[model samples]
Structures are given as C-alpha cells and as structure tokens.
Target: MRQINGQNSTSTIKQYSSTLLLMGSMLCSTHLLATTTATAYNANNYNAIQQTMLAEFALAYADTATALHNYTVLAIKSNSTTVKQRALNVALEQHDFKAALDIATHWVVQEPSDVPALFYLAHIALQAHEYELAAESIDKILSHDPSADLEKILAGIAPESKEDQTVLVDALQNSQAKDNPSILVIIAALEAQTGQFEQALATINRALKKRPNASNFILMKANLLSALGDEEQTRKWYSKASRQHKSNLEIRLAEVKYLIKVNDSMLALEKLEKILQKWPKAEEALFIAGLTSIDLKQYERAERYLVELRNSSQYQNDAYYYLALNAERKGHYETAKAYYRLVDGSLYAVSRQNLINIYTEQQRLNDALRFLTQERVNYPQHASFLYQAQAEILKKMGNKRAAIGLLEEAIQHLSDDPELIYAEVLLLDPFVQRDRLDQLLTLLLDLEPNHPAYLNAYAYTLALQNRRLDEARDYAERALEMAPDQASIMDTLGFVAYLQNDFSTAAKVLEQAYLLNDSVSIGVRYARALYMQGDLGRFAQILKQLQQKHPNDPQLAPLNSLLIPPPMPKSS
Candidate 1:
C-alpha cells in the first residue's frame, strides 16, 4: 500500500472523510477493507472492493456522474443501509433529484423507521411535484419524529398554486398531526391566500380554540371576516382583539387599518390618536394620523402630524409628498412647490406631476415646460413621461403644432415606447392627418394589443370618419370587455353603434355611459341617440342637463339647433 502524506494527499483525505460521513456505518467496513491483507479477500468480496475503490477514485477526481453511477450499482447489489445512503448523498450532491428520490424510496422501504431517509424522501417528492407521495413521506416522518419542522417543508410550496395548495390542505386535514396548532395556522394562511375565506375562517377558529389569546390568530379571523364581507363581525372581532391585546401594537394598528378600509376615517383617526398617546414615538401611527386628517380636511392637524414625520428616515419622502398635498389643498402654492421638490424615490414621479399641475393652474406654462425639460435631463429613465407632460403643457398653451413637434422628437429617441406614440396619435388631427393617425394607432396596438385606451381611440377615430363601422364596433366591443366599467370605452362603443344607425342600441348603451360619467362628449352622443330614437322628451331633458352643467361647452353648440321649432305651413 502507498503511504498517503503531503498537502495534496491531506486534501484528498479530507474529501474522503466527508464522503465517508455520507456513507455512515459503511465507513468502518470501507476502512477494514482497505486495511485487511490481500489473502483475506474472497472472490465475492474482491468485486465489491474493486467497485468501492473505483467510486472513491471517481470522487477524489470530482467525477460526480461516474461516482453516482458506481455507487447506485453498489447500493442495489448490497443490503447495507449505509451503501444506499451513500448513493443517495452522491445523487443529492450532483443535484440528480430523480435518482435521489429513487434511492431514498428504496432506503425507506428497507428501513421504514429511518427519520432522515423519510425527510429526504419527502423533500425530493416535493421537488418532483409528486404531492401525494410527498404527503405520505411527510406523514411518516412526523409519525417517527413528532417535532419535525413541517413549516420548513411547506414553505417550498407556492401560494399561487391553488390546486396544489388544496391537495396539501386535504392531506394535512387527514394527517395524524392535524391537531397541531402550528399546522393549523399555516393551513389557515394557505386557505386565505387561495381566497377560500370561509374555509380559512373555520381553520383559524380551530387554532384560536387551542390558543385563545393568540393575537395573530384573532387578527387572521378578523381579516377572514372582512374578506367574507361580514363588516359587522369584522368590526366586532377587531374591537375584541384590540381590547384583549392592549399592549400589542400590531393588533391595534390592524384595527386602525380595518377602520380606514371601511371608510370610517374619523374613527381611524381617533384610534390612531389613542395609539400615539401611549406610544408617543410610533412612526406608523403618526403617518396614518396625518393621512386620516387629510381625508377629514383638517389641514392644520395633518400638517402637524406630517411635520413630525419628516424626521423619520422611513417615512421622510412620503411625509414630504403628503405635506405638499396638504399645502396645495390649502392654496399655499409656494409652500407646496417647496415641499414637492424635497420628495423623491417612488413618489418622485407623482410629486413632479403635482408640481407641473400647480404651475399649469397658476398659468405659468413656460415654467412648467422648463421644469419638465430639467427633470427629463436629471432622470433619464423618466424621459418619455416627461416629454408627454411637456407636450400636454404645450397643448394647454394653445401650441398644438409645438406639442406634435415635441412628441415627434421624443418618439425619435424612444422609438419603441408605446405611451409616447399614443400621445402623439392623440395630438394628430384625425381629419387632417388620417394616414399618420392610422399608422400610429396600428403601431400602438402592436406594442400593447389589448390596451383598452388604444383600442378605444382607434374605434372612436374610425367612427368619426364613418368608415368601417363594423370593424370599429368590433374594436370598441373588445375594449369594453377588457375594461367593463370604463365610461370612456362605453362612450366609444355607443359612438360606434350610433354611426352604424343602430339608434336603439346607441341610446341604451350611451345612457349607461352617461350615467357612469356625465362628460360633455358622452352627454352629446347620448342626446343625439335619444333624438334619433324619437325619445323627444328625454332628449330635451338631457340637452337641458348638459347646458346647465357646461353652459359654454363648444360641443353643445350644434345641439342648440335640435331645440329650435320647425317652420309651420301657412293656412289656406
């Protein structure tokens, strides 16, 4: 035998030691085979020794596939559990989960009470998506070791896989460990994630029975009640939880959030004030109180809470944005602009938009354009949006040609940007630039085929020209289906119907659209549809309402002719 020594041999021996640890009891047998005299080996043992030597050589050289193959053969031929375990470890180290699963299953069959083998089998089955087999292995492992970490195993499952979640739920429901409160909690969470609120409620109630004072379970129950739309029960349970867990900030804050969700902003503010009275430095309570005050239009109180939050690192940007909103609502334009400039991160885009709106409302159009131009250079990632905003400011200033020119320049830089193309399409006069409008609309659809706004614009433009009314109707219907509650899409569909002379359909759909949003354009179409359908009284009522709402709307000028009485014939 060659003497093993030196740095290289020491490294190889260390690797062999780790490999032996995987083989468990086979380590001693392997050691004895290596040490025994040559005369002691019989023919049968000689083949086993030769294969073991080959596998060890493969491992030392880092030939994982060869090692796994030889080990798997050795494991099958021998009845030694350590040999099978070694093969399983080799397969696992190689990330050969299929071979690992097969070897683990064989190992378990040989030794049913092996906890580690069962654990490995369970995880392998989960990886293979063999849920039933995984469930069986998990059950067996739990039986052998009651303290097994089931949560760690279940964590691998995705919450979005409702079908897979349901299978696991059923298996756990019938499991020997079904009464485990930890298991019940996870099951409840999974049920809630899958939108099985009623079932989740039942599961959580069971956990609450085991641990009655568990604040998390109580909160889960309340949220489940909210999900089930039982508003009264949700309120009652949240109140009960708050009363029971007086020191628990999470429970109290959850109650405040629930109040806000139910639109009880006044009560939410009151609760938040109480929370702040106890925990004076609570940043979350201060933030919520500021927003709640804003909702109630108590500007002074909102400013006080928001100013305090400006010192908080977590809520600093959010506080600045809301402070700006509060100042704007109170008509302190300069203060609002100052606050908006300090806002950044995720709120930066909205804050900049607010500043632009403030400038526009103050009739400082040039200032708005200059600010947008500077922002585009500072934040190149938002350049397309800034260009769109600049174009709108130009349009507001009665510079439509400049707006179109700016958008054309933006499109040259951002050729694939759909929003820039759509903005330019909207700016183009349909009657004058028909081909260009059609070309951009086609391109916008290619970018986002199912975009409701793009589809609606295309349908409205086609209807405006009264060409291809059927195709226009098809596009409008598709858009309406995509955004069923969007009033603008409804208006487009109604316009398409009116263009096709389906006056009755137009009158019905346009009335719904008008009721949804009484915009001037939709109101005009509804009035015309009612007029064409011979509903003269309703048509007159709609005309009167439109005139009352928008006395000087240019779109309503054409409708004045409808109200004029026709010339009477002379009597003979």
Candidate 2:
C-alpha cells in the first residue's frame, strides 16, 4: 500500500483537486488488485457493464473473480473517472475490449498513476493501433514505477531478444488504431511482398510518423503507389525516397522499372544514362534499361548502353547479345556477327542463324556454308540449318548432283517443313529425264497441291520439255494462283502460254515477270514471242541487247546477227 499510496505529483494531482477536494477515505483507500486477462471487442454488441459498476462493487466477496464482479458493478454506476477505471478492468475480463478501450482512455486522461488503468490503456491502445498512445501509456507507467518497473514491464511485454518482432507484432494487432506509426512500418514490408500496394501505402504512412525521413519506407511507399496505378503519386514518393536514401540502389532501380513498364522508355533511358554517368558498372540497371529501349525500338540508344557495359567480361555475354540485335536492326551484318560471337546460350544459336542469314544475303554463300557445316558437327540433327546452308551453296556453285543429295536428305529429315519442301522441289529441276524428275514433282503435289513451289516446279519442267502443254498450263496457272507476284513462276506461266500458241497471254505474263526480276530466261522467251509476232524490228532490237549481255556466247551470236542488219560497214 505504501509503495503506490501517495497523491499524483503534478498535473494528475491537479486534475483531481479541481474535480473535488480529496475524500480522505477515498484518497487513502487500498489500491485495486491487478487482473490478467485482456478484452476482446464485438462489433454487434455494445458493452453494458459500465452502467452497473457501483452496485456490483458493494456486494463483491471471495477471490479476484468476485473482485472483478465488484469492479464491474462500480463501473456500471457512472461515467466518473473511478467508475471508468473499474469499467476498464471489468471490460477487460468480459473480453468487451472496445468498452475497456473506451474506459481506459478516460481513466488515463484523469489519472496517470492508476497503474492498472495505465497498463490496460496501453494494451488497448496497442490493440487499437494507437502506437503513440500505447507508448505514452506504457512510458507513464515506467515513469512512475521509478524503481525500474517500466523496463520490467516492456521486457515482459516484448522480451529483450525478440523485442523488435514483438513490438511489430503488437503494433500489427491494432488494426483499427487511429494512427499507429509502428504498425505502418512493418505492414509496408508485408504489403509490398504480397503485391497489396494500396493497403501497404496506408500502412507505411503510419511508419513515416515514427521515421519521417526513412529512405526504405519512402521507396516502398513509392513502389506501392506505382503498383496501385497512381503514377504521379508514385513519382513523388520515388523522388522523395531517392533524396532521402541517397545511396539506396533499390530506390533508383524501382524508378527505372516503373518508367520501363509504362512505355516511357525514353525517360527510363535518360535516367539510366544518369546512373551510368555516376556508377558506370551498374550491370542490372544497364541491362534492363537496354532491354526497355529495345522494346521501344530505340535501337541506337539501346546500343549505346550495351556497348558501355561490354567492357567487363562479366557483362560481355549480355552486352554482345543486345549489341548484335542492334546491329541487325541497322542492317550491319558483319557488325552484328562480330557482336554475336561473344554471346553464349540458346541466344547464341539465334545469333549464329542471323549471321548465316547475313552471309547468304550478301551472296557470300561459301561463308554461310562453312558456318552451318561447323554448327552441324555439334548440332548434326539441326535440319533447317543444314538444309539452308546446302541450298545456298548449290545455288551458287550450280553443282546439281551434290545439291540433289543434300535436298533429299533435308526432305527425309524434315518432311513436314515448308521451307525444306521448297528447297527439295528446286533440286528436282535441271535433271536430264523429265519423267524421273516429274515423279518427285507429283509426290510434292500430293503432299501440298496448293503449294506454289510444287506448282511452279512441275509446270516449268513440263513447259521446258515441250511435251505436255495442257498439264503445264494447269500447273503454271495454279502456281500463279498462289503467288501471282513471284517472278520465277510468272516466267513459267508465260512460256507455257507461248508453247500453247497463246502469244498475247505469253507477252503479258512475260512483260510482268521481266519487270519483276529481269531474268535472262524471261527476256529471251519474250524476244522469241516478239519474233513469232512478226514484229521484226522490235525483235531485232531485243536481240542486239541480248547479244551485248551474252557477248561472246556462240549460241546467241548467230541468233543475234540473224535478227539485226549488220551495223553498217560503218567505220570507213
């Protein structure tokens, strides 16, 4: 009794004096006993025990249970501070937590050293997420328990070893708190992890009250806002976090991700450039920013970022891959190939393929062949690579036999592939016996009758043999149906018409094909049709040009002079 017997020292004592001159008996009364349990609130039921406390106190007897009953009786009688304290205790026992919270708050404002009251109030405040109130309540108890009691209380509430976690847990339990700064800090982490950005932002704001300038919190808040689709707010938070946490790499990276995802890749690039200007080896930042620029089709800018990162062996793989793509976009084949070689992975395969394509495009067929042949040693079953290379080489060297072997092998290995089918059909042409080659064309037509390659191959072969004009015309017309724009097939169609004596149609198809690829075969066929047309002057003119093209060719020279008048014995 002596330990907690004295009047409150200052403001609390003054509050009591203003209310009433102390009743000597009330002032000197024995302190209330402590109770162990806490209150729980129910939204549907309002606690009615505050209206019955005084009556219950007088009839109480027996143990703490009876004491609790008496306290409930006293609390029910009035809204007085003493009644409020009793109601707080009874409310805690009945688990009428909200009522206990209401009473505890009232008691604390009136009297700080009401120890049981302070303890109850702090607990309620903590549960209610009123962190500052909870802390204030507990601190007051410690302040008065001058004999190291506050430390003991806090130690007991949140054991020293796991205290931070406990404090955070305690803060979390107070879901309805008016302003719980501590709870906000921890929820910031929780919400970000779960992708619950909106709730996370509000929770983190509470933490900001505790640490207004905390960089991590600011960054987290910014990221959450971004996730919530609040870009302007997100930017504001990002800027604040960057300023507050100047050395925080994560904050800067977060801002970069936001800019990239929203298609504001130009801004992302500028930010990344600034970062690289400051810290040149930020690999992840540079790589992601480069990819963003690539997505935006800003190839030149993407290349600059990639080239800067290419200096380090660690980043070399990625740097080279991105740089190769950039060079490819610019049509710099050799430059692309140089960059492609440094990369390793499945991406390396794409790089090799792209390089092969560049060689074929430049008509450096031997280079394309050698690369794929080497690749085949390691990837022997790669049908497309093997066939593309073989086809290009054969087309250049005109080695019909060797080309046939490769085409047959490609067809056998990749029977369902359209590209390989096209290459295979091309090989069937230029053979001596049209019948032996015609069998392959019929097989291809059976496989895909509408396929232009199959149509053109069969039609052109029949026309050249001059043996089946009706079948040739049907095949050529079908090929024209699919790729009316294909010059090679157009020539076949024209020649078939000419063989059928449809000279008007032959001239039209030939002229169109001539304008398309300007192939020698089409030009000669057209000149022949012109001669048969009795347009001798035009026919003569065409032969003169053809002779210039064939120059010393024996077959064309006689044919050429026979058509044109010998250039006047002009010289003299």
Please name the candidate that would achieve the greatest lDDT relative to the true structure.
Answer: 1
Candidate 1 lDDT, 1-572, residue by residue in tens: 11211111111111235446445434545656677785575454556656777887888899877888888887767667556656766776677778877877887787788776676677667656676787788778767666554544544443357777787777777777788765687688888888888988999898888888766677878889988999999999989888888899999999999999989999999999999999988999999999999989999999999999898899999999999999999999999999998888899889989999899789898988888888887889989888999999899889999999999999999989999999999899889999989989999899999999999999999998889899899999999989999998889899999888999999999999999999999999999999999999999999999999999999998888988899999999
What residue runs in model 1 are displaced by over 4 Å at the alpha carbon?
1-173, 186-206, 209-215, 224-249, 259-286, 293-316, 326-333, 466-474, 484-487, 493-520, 523-572
**Residue-wise lDDT of candidate 2 within 1-572, one digit each (tens)?**
12321121111211222123124213322111112223434321122332232335432432445545544444444334544544454455455556656666656665656775676676666445456666666556655653222212222233223444445445445434324444355445545555556667778777677667655566667767877888788777776666666667777777878777777778877777777777777888778877877877888878877877877657777789889988888788788988876666556667776677777788787777777677667666565756766675776778777777787777777776666656655666445646647766777787888988788888888887887889989988988899989998889988999999988888788878878875566778877777776777877776777677776656565457555666767575
- Top of the candidates by TM-score: 1
Steric clashes per prediction: 0, 15
TM-score of 2: 0.41
Tell me which residue pairs clash in candidate 1: none
